[model samples]
Target chain A: MNDEAACVLFDSGHRACGGCAAAMAARLILDAAGKDTIVVSSTGCMEVFSTPYPETAWGVPWIHSLFENNSAVASGVVASLKKQGRKEKVIALGGDGATFDIGMLCLSGAFERGHDFTYICYDNEAYMNTGIQRSGATPYDASTTTSPAGSCSFGNSRPKKDLPMILAAHGAPYVATASIAYPPDFKKKVEKAVNTPGPCYIQVHAPCCTGWGFEGEKTVAIGKLAIETGLWVNYEMENGVVTKVKKVVRKPVDDYLVGQKRFRHLFKPKRNDAEIAKIQALADRNAVKFGIDITLKK
Target chain B: MAIGTGCTARPGKSRNNKTGSWRVFRPEFINEKCTSCGMCRIICPEGCIGENEEGLPVPDYDYCKGCGLCAEECPSEAIEMKKEEK
Candidate 1:
C-alpha cells in the first residue's frame, strides 16, 4: 500500500460502479471539506457501497443514521458540537430519495432552526440503491423501473422538484445547485458551503449510469449535456439572492434525452414530438427563470 | 480487523476489497505523450491515480476499476484504454 495514495480522502476499492458519479461526488466533497469534517450520511446508495457492514471508504469522521433522519442527526451533531465548543464542519450527505422524498421534513426542520451544517444532496434523479425506483428528483418524462414508459404510460410525469429553491426559501445562508461534470465548480461550492456559518444546502446533479442507462464512461458527458440543454442549471444562491450562474448557449433537450435509455421511448417507435416538446418547454422555462441563455456572438 | 464495540470500524478500510479484478478494459498510462497536466488524477472516479515523484500519474491497479474516465477526459490524450486479458 502506497502511503501517498492514501492521501485521497475518499479511497478507492469501494463497491461503487465504474465511473459512478456519486463516487466522484463523494471524492470531490471530501477533497473540498478536508479531514477535519464530520459526515452524517443518510441511508442511500453511497452508504450502501462506501460502508457495507464494517468497511468504510471515508477518510474523515463519518456517521450514518436512518434514511429519513440524517438531517435531524446533523442537527443533533451541530448542537452537540456547539455545546463542546468544537469547530469541526458538519456535512449531512444524502441521495435524491433521502433528500427529495424521505428526508425533506428533517432537512426543513434543521434549516428552520439554522443549524451550522451543510446538507449536500447528490441527485442521481432516482433511487438507484433499491433498483432504480422513481424519485421526486426524476426529470419530466424519464422512465424508471417503477415508472416505465409503455404503450399507455409516458414515464414519470412530474418535473424534478426544485430542491435548491425550496432550501433557499428557508433563509439558508448559502444554497447552490451543481453537477458532477463541473468538478471545480462543485469543489468551490462545497468549500463555500462548509466555510459559511449558517445552514447551507447544495444539491449536486450526479448522473447515475446503472439507473439512467448510459455507459459508465459517459457519466461526465451526460451530466454536461444536462446542463448544456438547460435541463439542469448550475447556479449559486446566497441569502435568497442569485449571486452566480453558469450560462451556456443552450442546446436542444433532445440532445440530452437521446443519450439516455430512460428517454429511449421518447425517440423510438416514431418520434413522440408532442411529449418531447413539453420536456423542451420545461428546459425553456428554466432558461427564462435563471436567465442562463448566453447568446453566442456570431 | 477488530471493529470496536458497537460497530465502530477503522477509517478508510474499504481498501481491503481490491476492485482491479472487475475491469474489462485496463487503462495504460502513456508517460511519453503525457504533459503532466494532472487532469487524469483529478477526474478519476476511482481516485486510484496517484502522482509519481516526477509528477506523472500512476494508477494503483489494485483498486482502479478501469472506467476509462481519465482516458476520456485526458486533454493531452496521455492515457489509453487497452483490452484486459486474464
Candidate 2:
C-alpha cells in the first residue's frame, strides 16, 4: 500500500463489494482511532471478509471473537489494558445482527459495567452476511430473505429495535447515530467516543448496496436519502440526554424507499399508499420525537 | 501450504493475490480537471487510491477492482469510468 493509503488503519483490498458503505465506515473509524488501538470484531461480514485465514487487511492489532461475545471480549481486553496501565483504545465492531440481536446481552453487560471502550454497530438493517435475512434491526415492511413480501405478507412486520435508547438506558457515557454519507460527523463521533473515559456506543447507518437492491455507485446517495427523509435520524446523546441532531429538508419517505429493490414490492404495479403512508408516519414521528428541524433556510 | 491453526508465523500471505482482474470498469483520472480534493482517496473501498507528490489521487491499478466510487463521489468530476478493455 502507498503512504496515503497506509494512513488508514484498516488496510484495503479485502472482499467487500464495490461502493460498500460499511467498508467506508470502517476506514473512517480506524482513521479516527489512530494507531494505538485494538479492534475486536464479531463473526460477520467485516470480520470474515477482512481476515480470510492468512490474508489480514487490518494494520492495527485486531482480534476476531464469536458473534455473540465480541463486547465481552472487548471488555476483557479493556480490563487487561487497564491493569497494565496502557492507554490504547479498544473498539468492538459488529454488524446489526450481532449488535441488536445476538450480542445484545453481552453489549448490555459491557455498558452496564462501564468498560472503557467504544462499540460501533455498522447497521445495514439486516443480516447481510447471511444472505440478507431479517434481524431485529431490519426496518418495518422491508423485504428480506426470511421476511419476503408475498401475496399474504408485506415483508418484516416488526419495527427496528431502538438499540441506542437501550444503550443510553444503561447510562453509557456517549451514544450517537451516524450515517456513512457524513464522514466528518462520523469521524468526529468516533474520536469523541474513543476519547471519552467510559463505554460508548455509535450506531452507523451503512447502506448495503447488494442486499438493499441498489446500484453499487449509489451507496452514498442512498445514505443521504435515508437521513434526508428522516428514516434514519442522526443524533448524539451524552449521559442519556440528547445533544445534537442533524436537521433534514423533509423529503417524503417514498423518495428514500423507491430506489431500493427491498422496497420495490411497495411500489410495483401501483404505489402502496397505505404502506408508504405508514412508513412516512414512522419518519414523521422520528422527526418530532428527536426534535429534528425540518425548516429549510434560503 | 497446509499450516495448522495458530502455527503459521508469516502474516498477510494474501498479498500475492492480485485482484485487479475483477474490474468491469476502470477509472481514468483527468489531471487538468482534478482539483486535488482528496475525496476519492478518502472514500475508496479498496484504499488503492493514494496521493502522489503533487497531492493528486493516484490509483494503484493492480488492486483496484474498478468500483467506480471515486468517479461517483468526485465533486470535480476528475475521474471517469470506462468499460474495461479485455
Fnat for each predicted structure, in order: 0.72, 0.43
Please report the candidate that would top DockQ against the real structure: 1
Most lDDT-accurate candidate: 1
- Tell the DockQ for candidate 2: 0.54
Q: What is candidate 1's DockQ?
A: 0.60
Q: Which stretches of candidate 1 lie over 4 Å from their true place?
A: A1-7, B1-12
For model 1, the interface Cα RMSD in angstroms equals 2.9
lDDT for B17 (candidate 2): 50
The residue-by-residue lDDT of candidate 2 on A1-298, one tens digit each, is 1335344477766788878888888888887888899999999988887887778878888989998999999999999999999999999999999999999999999999999999999999999988999999999999999999989988999999999999999999899999989888998999999999999999999999989999778888899999999999999999999999999788889889999999999999889999999999999999999978567667
Report the TM-score of chain B alone for all candidates. 0.86, 0.85
- lDDT, residue A219, candidate 2: 88
Taking the tens digit of each residue's C-alpha lDDT, what string does model 1 give over A27-114?
8888888878999999999999998667778888889988899999999999999999999999999999999999999999999999
lDDT of each: 0.90, 0.89
lDDT of 1 at A35: 79
